[model samples]
Target chain A: MKRRTRKAFISLIIAIAAFAILAIELYPIAITVINGFRRDIVILSGQPFKLSQLTLRSYQMVLKNIGFQLGMKNSIIIGLLSTGISVLIGAMASYGIARFRFSWRNGLAYSFLVFRMLPQISLVIALYLMFSYVGIRDTIGGITLAHTSFNVPYVIWLLLPFFTAVDKAYEEAAMVDGCNRYGVFFRIFLPIVAPGLVVAAVFAFLNSWNEFLYALILTGVNAKTAPIAINGLLGGETLTWGQACAAGTLMLVPVFFFTLGMQKFLIRGITAGGVKG
Target chain B: MSSRKPDTDGVSVSLIKGKARHRAPFLFLLPALLVVFAVLIFPIVFSFFVSGFNWPLSEGAGTRKFVGLGNYLALSVDPEFWNSLKLQLGFIFIAIPIELLFGFAAALLLNREFFGARLVRSLLLLPVFFLPILSGMTWRFMLQPRYGPLNALLLKLGAPEITWLGRPVTAYAAIIVQDIWRMWPFMFMLLYAGLTSIPQELNEAAEIDGAGFWLKLRSITIPMLTPTIMTAVLLRIIDALRVFSEVYVMTEGGPGSSTTLFSLYTHRQAFGYQKVGMASAMAIFLLCISIAFALTLVRKNMSLDSLEEKAGGG
Candidate 1:
C-alpha cells in the first residue's frame, strides 16, 4: 500500500510538470498555428479556440506579400552561397590544423575561435556603419560577405574534429594507389569526412538563414531576411496575431527541415565541437 | 603499414608529407580569408578608426570631425554608460549561477536511465533552436497581464495576476525567467554530454567502496564535469554579456530604461542620442570583457585536452 501510494505521488508530480512544460511551449505554438489559418484576428478575439473560425486567408495574404517572397529568395541564395564558401574553407583550415604543423597554426586557429566568441550582436553596429559607408549596405553580396566573416570561423571549428580523426593513411593509400594530392583529397579524404562537411554546412546555413540583428540594421527593402521583415511588420493596434503567426510559421519551415530528425547529429556537432566528429 | 611512424624511418617522408599537406589547407583557406577580411576584419579596424572621429555612416551628418579619445573619455563619465554596465554585470551575476544550478539539477535528473529519456532531452533542445526574438515575443504574449494564459492561470489559482514586465523588479524578473528558461537547456546539454563521457568504471569503483547516491555524485560526477561546466558557464557568460535581441524584442529597453543592458546602452548612445565616440568607447569595454572571458576559456580548453592526453598516456 505504501509503495503504491509513493508511485502515485511521483506519477502525479510528473504529470503536473509535463503539463506545465506543454503549456509554456506547445500552447504558444498552438495559438500561433490556429491564428495562422484565421482570416482576421478579430474573429479569434471573440472565440480564440473555435475550429470553425479558421480560414487560409492569412497564409494566402502573407504568401502574396512580395517582401516575404523576396526575403525568402535572398535568404536561400545567401545561405547557400555562404555555406558553400565557408565549408570549402573550413575543410581546408581544419585539415591544415589537424594534419600539419606550422609556426602560426595556433594563432590561425585562435583567430577563428575568436569569431565564435564574437557573435554578430557585439559588432553589429560597427559593421552597419562601415558597410553603409562602403556602399555595400543593401546588397545581397554585402550580406553574404558579412556572413562569411562569421561563417568561415564556424566552419573551420565545426570541421576540425572530422579532419583530425580521419587517418592520414587514407590520403597516403590513395597517393600510393597512383593518385596526386588533389586526386587523393577529392577521391578519398572528401568522401571519408562528408558528414562533418555536411554538419558544418548546415550550421553555417542556419546561422546565415536565421540571423536578424545585422539584417535589421544593414538592410531595408533591399536585403531584409524573413525574420526582420516579419518582426518589422508586427506592431501597433491591429497587431494581427494571424499575420505574424503565418509569417513566423513560414520562416520556421527551412529551419524545421534542417533540424528534422537530425537533432543528434546537430547536438553532437555543437557540443562535440568536432572533437568526436 | 609501410614505415608509417613519423619518428622512425618515416621522418623525412613525414617532413615532406607534412609540408605538402599544408599546401592544400592554405589554398582552401584563401577564399574564406579574403571574404572574412573584406567583411569582418576590415570593419573591426575601420570601426576603431571611426570611433576616434565623430562620424556617422551618413555623409550629410558631418565630415569626420576628429575627436581624439574624446569618446573614451566621455564613455567613462556617462552615467547611462555606467548604469548599462551595472545592468549587464547584474544580469551576469544573477543569470549564470541560476542557470548553472537549474541546469545541473535537470541534468542530474535526466542523467538517470528513465523511460522517456530521449523525449525529455529533445524537449530541452526545443528552446535552443528557438530564435531569441521569437522567444521574447512568445513569452511576452504568455505573460500579458490581461488576456495572457499566465495571468488567467494565476487568477484561477486565487493569486492576483501580477504585471510581470510593467514595473521595474517584476519586469527585470521576467527577463531573468525568460533567460533562464532559454539558457538552462544549454547548460543541461553541455553537462549531460559531459556526464555521459565520464567512464562508468569510475562509478562502479565508487559503488564497490559503498558510496551512496549523494556521495557518489558529490565526488565522482562533479569533478569530472567541472571542465565542461566551465566551458558552458564561459559560453553563457560571454553570451549573457551581449544580451540584446531578446531584450529588444521584449521590452526595447523600456519602463524608462530599466532593462537597458550594455549593448542596448551602446545602441541608444550611437543611434538614439548620437554619441558615436562614447558608444565606441563602450563597445571597446564590451570587447574587453568578452575577450577576457573567452580567452580564459580557450586557454583552459587547450590545456585540459593536453592534460587529458598526458593522463591517458600515463
Candidate 2:
C-alpha cells in the first residue's frame, strides 16, 4: 500500500510538472492561433481563452496585404537560395576537412568559428554602406549573402561528422575498380551522406528564413523578410496586436516543417563536431 | 624478403598522384568563402578603418580626422557604455538561474516515462523555436493591461493586474520570463541528453544501499551531470549577453533605458547616434566579456572539452 501511494505521488508530480511546462509554452500559441482567425482583435484579447466565438477575417486581411505577401516571398526566396548555396559549399568544405589533410585546413576552420561568434550587427552597418555603393541595396541577393555567411559555418561544422563517418575503404575500393574520383563520390559517397545533407540544408534554410537583423537594416521594400514585416505591422504609431499575430501565424508554417526535418542532427548539438578553437 | 616487398616505384608514384588528385573537392569550397569574405570580413575590416575616421556613415567624407585610440579612450569615460555593461550583466544574472532551474526541472520531469511523453517533449521545444520578434510581440499583447490574457488570468485568480512592460522592474521581469520560455528548452535538452548517458548501474547501486530518490539525484545525477549543466549555463550566459532581437522587438530598452543590453546599446550608439568609433570600442569590450567568460568556463569545465577531444580525436 505504501509503495502504491509513493508511485501515485510521483505520478502526480510528473503530471503537474508536464502540464505546467506545456501550459507555459502552449498558452501563447493557443491564444495567437485562435485569435489570429477572429474578426476582431478587441474580442479575442478581451476573452482570449474562449472557444465560443471564431472567425477567419484576420487571415483574409493578411493574405490581401501587399507588404505581407512581399515579405513572405522574400523570406521564401532568400531561404531557398541561401540554403542551396550554403549546403553545397558546406558539404564540399566539410568533405575536404573530413577526408583530406590540406595544409590550411585547421587555420581556416578556426577562423570560420570566430566569424560565427562575432556579433551580427557588427557587420550590418558596414554591409549597408557597401551594398548601397555596389547598387545591391534592397536586393534579396545581398541579404541572402549576409545570412549565408552566418549559416554556412554552422552547416560545415555540423556536416563534417557525417562525411567522416563513411568508411574510407569505400573510396579505396572504388579506386581499385577504376572509378575516377568524381564517379566514386557520386556513386558511393553522396548516397551514404544523404540524410546529413538534408538535415544541414533544412537547418540552413530555417536560420535564413527566420533571420531578422540584417534583413531589418539592409532592406526596405524589395527584400524585407517576414520578421521585419511582422515588426512593421505594429507601425510606430500604435501596437496592432491582431494584425501582427496574423502575420506571425503565416511566418511560422515553413519554420515548423523546417525544424521537424532538422531536429535529429541537432540532437548532439553543434559543438561536438570537432576540435574546439 | 625483397620479393615480399614487390612494389615498383611507378606504382607508388601513381598512388601519390591519386592522393594529389582530390583537389577538385576543395575547389568546391570557393563560392562559400568568397561570399562570406565579401559580406562579413570586408565589413569588419571596413568598420575598423571607419573607426579611425571622424567621417560620418552618410554622404561625402569631408573633414576626415585621424583619431587613433581616441575612440577606445572615450569608452573609459562613457557612462552609457558602463550602464550598458552593467545592464548586460543584470540580464545574465536574472535570466541564467531561472532558466537553469526551470530547464533542469522540466528535463527531469520529461525524462521519466509518462502518459504523453513524446507529445510533451515536442511541445516543450515549441517556445524555443518561435521566431524572436513574434514571441516578443506576442508577449507585448499578452502584457496589455486591460485586454491582455495574462492580466485577465491574474484577475480571474483574484490578483490585481500590474503594468508589465510600462515600468523598469516589471519590464525586465517580463523580458526575463519570455527569455526563460525560449531558452530553458535548450538547457533541458542538453541536460536530458546528459541524463540518458548516465549508467543505470550507479542509480541501481544507490537504491540498493538504502538511498532514496532524492539522495540518488543529489549524489549521482547532479554530480555526474555537472559538465553538461555547466556547459549549457555558460552557453546561455554568453547568449544572454548578446541579447537583442527579443529586447529590441519588445521594449527597445525603454521605460527609459531599462533593457538596453550591450548588443542593442552598441547598435544604437553606432547607428542611432552615429558614433561609429565609440560603437566599435563598445563592440570590442562586449566581445572581451564573452570571450573571457568562455575561456574561464572552458578552463573550469575541462571534462566536457575532454569528451569532445575523445570524440573528435583531437
Candidate 3:
C-alpha cells in the first residue's frame, strides 16, 4: 500500500510537470495572438492576460504598411531562390562525396562541416564589403547569394548521409544501360533522395526566412527582410503592441505550420546533424 | 560468364574509365566549391587581410592605411571587449547547465508512455521555430515592469513590482531566462533522442538486480548518454557565444553594457562606430575562441568514443 501510494505520488508529479510544460510553451504564443487582435493598447498594457474584444485593426494596419509588404516580398524571394539553389548544389556535392572516392574527399567534407559551424558574424563584414564593391550589396540577389553560401554547406551535410544510404546497384544498373553519369544522377539518384531533398529545402527556406543579421547588415532600404522590418516596428518611438504582435504573428505563420507538418523529418535532421558532427 | 566480353572493346572501356575516374568527382564538386569559396573562404581570407588595416566605411578602401598588429594590441587592453568576453562565458556557463538539467528532467518525464505525448512533444518544439527576433520582442514586451504579465502576476501575489529590464541584474537575468526558454527545448529534444536510443536491456537488467530508479539512471542511463550530451553541449556553447538577435532586439547590449555579447559588440564596432578594422580584429578573436572550443570537443569526442567502446566490450 505504501509503495502504491509512492507510485501514485510520483505519477501525479509527472502529470503536473507535463501540464506546466504545456502551459509555458503555449502562453507566449497565445498571448501574442491575443494581443494582435486587441485594438486598445491601454487595455493590453493593463491586463495582458485578460481577454478583450477582438478586432482586425492591428492586422489591417500592418498589412497597409508598404515596408512590411516589400519586406514580405523580399523575404519570400530570397528564401525560395536560396533554398532552390542550395538544394541543387548540395545534392550534387553530396553525391560526389558519397559515391566517388577521391583523395581529398574526407578533407573537403570536414572543411564543409567547419564552415557550417563557423559563426556568421565572423564572415559578415568581409561579405558586406565584397558585395558592396561588386555592386550587389543591397539587392535581393545579393542577399539570396549570401543565404545560399551559409545554407549549401548545411544542405550538403544533411543530404550526404541520405545519399550514402541509397543503394549503389541502382546507379550501377542505370549506368550500364547507356545512361551518362549526369543522367543517372538526375533520373535515379535524385528521385531516390527526393524526401531528403524536401527536408533540406524546407530547412533552408526557414533558415533564410528567419535570418536577421545578414539582412540587417547586407541590405538597406532595397531588400529588408521581414525580421528586420518587424524589428524596426519595435525600435519606433511609440510602442504599438498590437501592430507589432500582428506582424510577429504573420511572420510565424509559415514556419509554425511547416514545422508541424514536417516534425518527423525535422527532428531526425537535427538529431543526425548533432550526432554525426 | 557465358558471354565473354569482346577484346576489341578494351580501348573504348579504358578510355571511358579513365575519363570518368579523372573528371567526374571534380565536375560534381565544382559548383558547390565555387559558391563556398566565393561566399565563405574568400571572406575569411579577406577578413584576415583587412584586420591589419585602419579601415572605415566612410573612407574608401583605397584610402585605407595599414596598422600592423594595432587593432589586436588595442583589443588586449580594451575593457569593453574583455567585459563582453566575460559576459559570453558567463552566459554559456550559467545558461547551458540549467538548460541541460531542465531539459533532462523534462525528457525523463516525457520518456514514459503517457496521454498526448505526441502533442506535448510537438508543442514543446514551438519556441525553437519562432524567429529569434520575434521571440525576443515578445519576451521584452511580456517583461515590462508596469504592464507585463509577469509583473502583474507578482503584484497579485503581494510582491513589489520590480522593473524587470530596467536594472542591470534583472536585465541580465531576463536575457538568460529568455535564452533558456528559447533553447531548452532543443536540448530536451536532443537528450530525449539520446534517452530513447539507449538499449532497454541494460535498464531491465539493472532493475532485475534490484536497482532503484536513481541507481539505474546513474549507472545505465548517463554513461550511455555522454556522446549526445557532449554534442549538445558543444553545439549550444558555440551558439551561445555568438548570440546576437535576441540580445540585440531585447537589450541592444544596454542597461549600461551589462549584456553586450561578443557578436553584438563586434556589430557595434563595425557598424555603430564604423571601426571596421577593430571589429575585424574582434571577429578574429571570436574565431579563435570558437576554434579552440571545437578542437577540445573533437579531442574529447575521440576519447569518449574509445571509452564507450571499452565499456561496451567489457
Candidate 4:
C-alpha cells in the first residue's frame, strides 16, 4: 500500500509537469491570438481580457494599409520564385549525390552543408555590395536570387535521405525496360520521392517567406517583406500594439494551417535539416 | 590484398553495368553547382578579397583602396568587436544548456504512450513555425512596461512592476527569455526524436535487472542519445553565435551596448557606419567560427563510408 501510494504521487507530479510545459509553450501564442481581436484602447488599457472589449478594428486597419499590402505581395512573389528554383536545382543535386559515385561527390555534399551552416549576415554584406554594382539591388529579382542561394543548399540536404533510400531495383528495372537515363530519373525516381519533394518545397517556401536579413539589406522600398512591414509598426514613439498583433496573426494564418496539415512531413523535415543549422 | 582485389573487382563490374561510362552524374550536378558557385561561393571569395581593402559603401566602387590586412588589424584592437564576440559566446554558454535541459525534461516526460501525446507533439511544433520577427514583436508587446499583460499579472499578484527591457541586465535577460521561448521547441523536437529512436529492448533489459529510472537513464538512454545531444548542441551554438533578428527586434542591442551580438555589431558597421570593409572582416571571422563548428560536427558524427559510399563499399 505504501508503494502504491508512492507510485500514484509520482504519476501526479509527472502530470503536473506536463501541464506546466504545455501552458508555457502555448501562452504567448494564445495571448497573441486573443489580443488580435481586442480593441487597441482595450489592449493598451490592460483590459485585453474583458469580453466586451473585443473588436475587429485592428484587422481592418492592417488589411487597409498600403505598405503592408505591398509587403505581402512582394513576400508571396519572392517565396514562390525562390522555392521553385531551389526545389528544381536541389532535387537534381540530391539525385546526383545519392545515386552516383564520383571523385568530387563527398566534397560537394559537405560543401553544401557548410554553405547551409553559414550565417546569412556573412553572405549578405558581400551580396549587398555585389548586387548594387550589378544594378539588381532592391528588385524582386535581386531578393529572389538571394533567397535561392540559401534555400537550394537547404532543400538539397533535406531531400538527400529521401533520394538515397530509393531502391536500386527501381532504377535498374527502368533501364532494362528501355527507359533512357533521363526517362528513368523523370518517371521512376521522381515519382518515388514525390512526398519528400513536396515537403522540401513547402519548407523552402517558408524559409524564403520568413527570411529577414537579406530582405532588409538587399531591398529598400520595393521589396520589403511582411516581417519587415510588421516590424515597421513597432518603431517610433507610439506603439500600435493591437495592429501589430493583428498583423502577426494574419501572417500566421497560413502557417497555422500548414502545421496542422503537414505535421508528419514537417517533423521529418525539421529533424533532417534543423540539426545542420 | 587478396580480399581487396575481390572487392575492387566486384565494384568495377557493377560500375560498368550501372552507367556504361555515360556522363549522367556530371550533367545532373551541373545546374546546382553553377548556381551555388555563382551565388554563394563567388560572393564568399569576393568578400574575403574585399576585406583587404578600405571600401566604403557611400563612396562608389572606384574609390576603394587596397589596405591588405589593415581592417583585420584594426578589428584585432577594436573593443566593440571583442565585446560583441564575447557577448555572443556568453549567450551561447548560458542559453544553450538551459534549452537542452528544458527540452530533455519535456522529451522524457512525453516519451510514453498517452492519450494526448499526438496533440501535444503537434502543438509543440507551433512555436517553431512562428516567424522569428513575429516572435520578437510578441515578446516585446508582452513585456511592455505599463500596459503589458505580464505587468498586469504582476500587479494583481501584488509584486512590483519591473521595466523588463529598460535597463541593461533586464534588457539582456529579456533577449535570453525570448530566445529560450522560440528555440526550446527545436531542442525538444530533436531530443524527442532521439528518445524515440532509443531501442526499447535495452530499457526493458535494464528494467528486468531491477534498474530504476535514473540508473537506466544514466547508462542506457544517455549513452545512446549522445550523438543527437552533440548535434543539437553544436547546431544551436553556431546559430546563437550569429544571432541578429531577435536581438535586433527586441533590444536593438541596447539601453547601452549590453546586448550587441556578433551579427548585430557587424550589421551596424556595414549599414549604420557604411564601413563595408570592416564589416567584411567581421563576416570572415564569423565564417571561420561557423566552419570550425561544422567541421567538428561532420568529423565527429559521420563515418567515412557514410560520407561517400562506393559500389564496392556498399
Candidate 5:
C-alpha cells in the first residue's frame, strides 16, 4: 500500500512535468497564431492571451505583399527542385555504394557522411563568391544548386541503408529474366525503396525550404525565400508585429501539416540515423 | 554447369564481368560525384584559395591581392574571434546537457503507454519543424520586457517584471532558451527512439533480479542507449557551434558582443564589416572544428560497433 501510494505520487509529478513541457512548447506557437489574427498590436501588448476582436487583416496584408508572394514561389521552386535532384543523384550514388564493391567505396561513403555533417555557414562565403563569378548569384537556380549540394549528401546517407537493406535476389532474378540493370533499378529496386525516397524527399524539401544562410547570402531580391522574407519584416523602420506573426504563420502552417502527415516516416528517418550500419 | 567452367571461356567471361562490375559503380556514382565536386568540393578549395588572399566582396577577384596567412595571423590575435569561440563552447557545454536532461526526462515519461502519447509526441516535434527565423521572431516578441506574455504572466503572479532581453545575461539566457525550446525535441525524439529500441527482455531480467527503476536505467538502459546518446550529443554540439539564425533574429549578438556566437561573428565580419578574408579564415577555423568532431564521431561509431559485436558474441 505504501509503495502504491509512492508510485501514485511519482506519477502525479510526471504528469505535471509533462503538462509543463506541453505548455512551454505550445505557448509561443499559440501566441504567434493568435497575434496573426489580431488586428490591434496594442491589444497584444495589453492582453496577449485574451481572445478579443480577432480579424484576418494581418493575414490579408501579408498575403497581398508582393515580396511575400515572390518568396513563397521561390521557396517552393527551390524546395522541390533541390529535393528532386538530390534524391535522384543521391539514390544512384547510394545504390552504387550499396550494390557494388570497389576499392574507394568506403571512402566515398564516409566522405558523404562528412559532407552531410558540414556546417552551411562554413561554405556560404565561398559559394557566394563562386556563384557571383559564374553569374548565377541571385538566381533561383543557383540557390537550388547550393541546396542540392547539402541535400544530396544527406539523401545519400539516409538512402544508403535503405538500399543496402533491399534483397539483392530480386534484382538478380530480374536481370536473369532479361531485364537490364536500368530496368531492374527502375522497375524493381526503385519501387521497393519508394518509402525511403519519400522520407529523403520530405527532409530535403523541408531543409531547403527552411534554409536561410545560403538563401540570405546567395540571393538579393529576385530569389529570396520565405524565411528571408519573414526575417525582412523583423527589421527596418516599423515593427509590424501583427504582420510578421501572420507571415510566420504562413511560413509555418504548411510545414506543420506536412510534418504531421509524415510524422511516422520522420520518426523512422530520425531513428534510422541512430541505427548502426 | 556449363563449358564456361573450362579455362579459356571462364577467363574471358571473368574478365568481362570484372570490367562491367568496375564500370557499373562509377556509372552510378557519376552524377552525385559531379554535383559534389561542382558544389561542395570546388567551393571548399576555392574558399581555401580565397582565404589566402585579402579578398573583398566589393573588389573583383582579379583585382584582389594575396595576403597569405595574414588573415589567420590576425585571427589568432583577434579578441572578437576568441570571444566568439568562447561563446560557442559555452553555449555547447551549457545547452547540450540541459537539452539532454530535458529530452531524457521527456523520453522517459513518454516511453510508457498513455492515452495521448501519439498526439503528444507529434506536438512535441512541432518546435523541430518551426522555421528558426520565425521561432526567433516569436520568441523575440514574446520575451519583450513590458508587453511580452512572459513578463505579463510575471506581473500577474505579483513578481517583478524582469527585463528578459534587455541585459547581457538575460539576453544570452533568452537565446539559450529559444534554442533549447527549438531543439530539445530533436534530442527527445532521438532519445525516445533509443529508449524504445531497448529489448523488453533486458529490463524484465533486471526486474527479476530485484532491480529498481534507477538500477535498471543505469545498468541496462543507459548502456544500451550510449551510441544513440553519443550520436545525439555530437550532432547537437556540431549544430550548437554553428548557431546563426536564432542569434541573428533574437539578440543580433548584442546588447554588446555578449552573445556573439561563431557563425554570427563570421557573418558580421563578412557582411557587416566587409572583411571577407578574415571571415573566410574564421569559416575555415569552424570547418576544422567540424572535421575534428566528425573524426571523433567516426572513431566513436567504430568503437561502439566493436562493443556491440562483443556484446552480441558474448
Candidate 6:
C-alpha cells in the first residue's frame, strides 16, 4: 500500500510537469488560433477580451485578400512540382548508389550530404544571380527549380537507406522472372520502398512549402508564397495582427493534418538524417 | 545455395561484374546528376567567379570590373561582419544547450506509457510544422509590448510590461526563446527515437542489479546515446548558423543590428546594399564554415559497410 502510494505520487508529479510543459509549448499556437477569431481592436488593446467577442472578420479578410490567394496557389504549385521532381530524381540516384558498385559512389553520396548542409543564403545568392541572368528570376519556374536543387540532396539522403535495405533476392528473383533492371526497379523496388518514398515526399513538400529565404530572394510578386504574404501584413500601412494570425492558421492547416497523420513517418524522417549525418 | 540469403559482399561483387556489361546504374543516375550539376554546381562555380569582381546589382552584370580578393578583404576588416559572426555563434552556443536540456526532459517525460500520450506527442510537434516566418510573426504578436499576451500576463503578475522586441537584449532573447520553442520538439523527437532504440534488455538488466533511474541513465542510456546526442547537437549547430527567416521576420536583425546573424548579414550585404560581389564572398565564407562542419560529421560517422548494414538491419 505504501509502495502504491509512492508510485501514484511520482506519477502525479510527472503528470503535472507534462501538463505545464504542454501548456507552455502550445501557448503560441493557442494564441494564434484564438487571436484569429478575435477582433483586431481587442487583440491590440492588450487586455483580456470576452470569448463572446470572437468573430470571423479576420478569416473573411484573409480569404478576400488577393495576395494570400495568389501566394497560396504559388506555394502549392511550387511544393508539388519540387517534391515530385526531387523524389523521382533522388530515388533514382539513391538506388544507384545503393545497388551498384561504381567509382566516386561514396564521393557522390558525401557530396549530397554536404550539399544538404549548404546554407540557403549561400546557394540562393548564387541562384538569384544565375536565375536573373537566365531571365527566370521571380518566376514560379525559377523558384521551383531552386527548391528542387536543395530538395534533391535531402530526398537522396532520406531515401538512401530505404534503397540500400532491400534484399538481393528481390532483384535476382525479378531478373529470373525476365524483368529488366528498369522493370525490377520500377515494379519491385519501388513498391517495397513505397512507404519510405511517401515520407520523403511529404518532407520534401514541407521543406518547399515552408521555405522562406529562397522565396524571399528568388521570388517577387508573381511567385510569392504564403509566408511572404503573411509577412507583408506586418509591413503594410495598418498592421493586421488578426489577419496575419488567420493566414498563419490557414497556412498551418496542411502541416497540422500531416503532423497528426504522419506522426511516425515524420519522426523517422527527422531522425534518419541525423543518425547517419 | 540459391535458396540461402546471399552475402552482401558476394552480391556487391556480382553487381559490379554485371555493371561492367550494362549501363543501367549510370543511366539511372544521369538525370539527377545533370540537374544537380546545372542547378547546384554551376551556381557555386559562378559565385566564386563573381566574388572576385566589383559586382553590384545596380551596375548591370555586363559592366562589372574585376577587383580580385577585394570583397573578401573588406569582409575580413568589416566590424559589422565580426558582430554578426559573434551574434551567430552566441545564438548557437546559447540556444542549442537549452534546447538539448529541455528537449531531453520532454523526451524523458513522454517516453513512458501514459493515457493521451500519443495525442500529446502529436501536439508537441505542432511548432516544428509551423512556417518559420509565421513562427516569427506569431512570436512577434505574442511579444508585442502593447498588445502581446505575454506582457499582459506579466502585468497581471505585477511586473513591468516588457518591450520584448524593442530593445537589443530582449530582442535577441526573444529570438532565442522563439528558437527554443520552435526547435525543442526536434531534439525531443531525435532523443526520443534514440531512447526507444536503446535495447530494452540493457535497462532491464541494469534494473535487476538494483540500479536507480539516474544511475541507469548514466551508465546504460547516455553512453549508448552519445552518437545520437552528438549528431543532434551538430545538426542544430549547422541549422542555427544558417538561421535567417525567423530572425528576419522577428527583428529583421534590428534594434540596430544586434540580432543580425550570419545569413541575415549576408542577405543585407547582397540585397539591402546591392553588394553582390561582397555577398558572394560572404556566402563562400559561410559555405566553407558549413563544409567544415559537414566534413566533421561525415568523417566521424561514415563507414560505408556499417551504413549499408545498418539500413539492412532496420
Q: Indicate which candidate wins on DockQ.
A: 6
Question: How large is the i-RMS for each model, in angstroms?
Answer: 6.7, 8.5, 9.2, 5.3, 8.0, 6.1
What clash pairs does model 6 have?
Answer: none
Candidate 1 runs further than 4 Å off: A1-31, A38-52, A271-277, B1-25, B57-63, B303-314
What lDDT score goes with residue A70 in model 1? 84
A45-83, model 4: which lDDT tens digit per residue? 864356566799989998998878988999999999999
List, residue by residue over B31-78, the lDDT tens digit for candidate 5.
999999998888778778878988777854335678999999999999
Q: Which residue pairs clash within candidate 2?
A: none
Interface RMSD for candidate number 2?
8.5
Task: Report per-candidate TM-score of chain A alone.
Answer: 0.86, 0.90, 0.94, 0.92, 0.93, 0.96
TM-scores of the candidates in the order shown: 0.89, 0.89, 0.92, 0.93, 0.91, 0.94
**lDDT (0 to 1) per candidate:** 0.72, 0.73, 0.82, 0.82, 0.81, 0.84
Q: Which 10 consecutive positions of candidate 2 chain B have the poorest summed lDDT?
A: B1-10
Worst 10 residues of 1 chain B by lDDT: B1-10
Clashes, model 1: 0
In candidate 6, which residue ranges exceed 4 Å CA deviation? A48-50, B1-21, B60-63, B311-314
Please rank every candidate by TM-score, starting with the best: 6, 4, 3, 5, 2, 1
User: If both were scored by DockQ, which would come out higher, candidate 2 or candidate 6?
Assistant: 6
Error of 3 at A267 (Å): 3.2
lDDT of 4 by residue, B6-55 (tens): 11223444532457345658887888889888788889898999899998
Candidate topping lDDT: 6
lDDT of 6 by residue, B1-314 (tens): 01222234444455434643456478878878988898888888988988998888876544688999999999999999999999999899999999999888888888886656777777888888888988898888889886788898898899999998899999999999999999999899888888988889999999999999999989988898888889889888878879999999998999999999999999998888888899999999998898888767765667345567776566
Which segments of model 4 are wrong by more than 4 Å? A1-13, A271-277, B1-17, B60-63, B303-314
User: Compared with the true structure, what per-residue lDDT tens digits does model 6 show for residues A140-229?
Assistant: 999999999888988888887677777777887778788888888899899999988998999899899889998999899899988889
Q: What DockQ does each listed candidate score?
A: 0.34, 0.42, 0.47, 0.47, 0.47, 0.52
| Tens digit per residue, CA lDDT, model 1, B199-277 | 9999999999999999998999999988788888888887888788788877777777788988888888777777565
